[model samples]
Target: MADQPEEVRRLLEAIDALAAIEDDATCASAVTALLNDWPTHHARLREIRQERVLALRDSGRTWKEIGDLLGGVHASRAQQIAKGLRGTKRPVKGADE
Candidate 1:
């Protein structure tokens, strides 16, 4: 849970609210709806993270510095996340598909 995002907290709240549903089928349906949307939610979180990375990079921070601020990943990994390198790489997958 150390690296969990803030969005997860909100999602947990939504899941918890499902407890009020008495019908099993209805409750399961609601839960499924929430779970199904997770990918989109995750992508949004990533987009926000990337924005922060760009802001940091614009402020003259190096990938190593960014990695340090982010959880200690390698510099190249940080660079890839912040500003994707050129080549024949595929586009990043978004939550909405």
Candidate 2:
């Protein structure tokens, strides 16, 4: 099935709303609403985001570049997530892999 642009808009709107909320409980509920309303959209969004990260790395871009292109997340965190998703045996510093 093809993804609709409106669905992505809705997901972004919902995330924006959640981020605007001050209370943790309200934020949680907002996220739940977003998940229930657009589970497939969120899943697709995640896939797209992951692909972007991978492509940035493949293009010889640094983790900082990838993170900046995707959003404002830290470079190290983006690198870690990318490595984990690719099943790389990254050093976890004692925690379970």
Clashing pairs in 2: none
Off by over 4 Å in 2: 1-37, 83-97
* Among all candidates shown, the one with the greatest TM-score: 1
After superposition, the stretches of candidate 1 with alpha carbons farther than 4 Å from their true spots are 1-27, 84-97
lDDT of 2 at 3: 53
lDDT (10s digit) by residue, model 1, range 1-97: 4457787777666667797789999999988897799899878877887889899999999999999988897888778877644225677889458
The C-alpha local distance difference test score for the whole of candidate 2 amounts to 0.74
**Each candidate structure's count of clashing pairs:** 1, 0
lDDT of 1 at 32: 88
Instruction: Check candidate 1 and list the clashing pairs.
Output: 40-95
CA lDDT of each prediction against the hidden true structure: 0.80, 0.74
Scored against the true structure, residue 66 in model 1 reaches a CA lDDT of 94
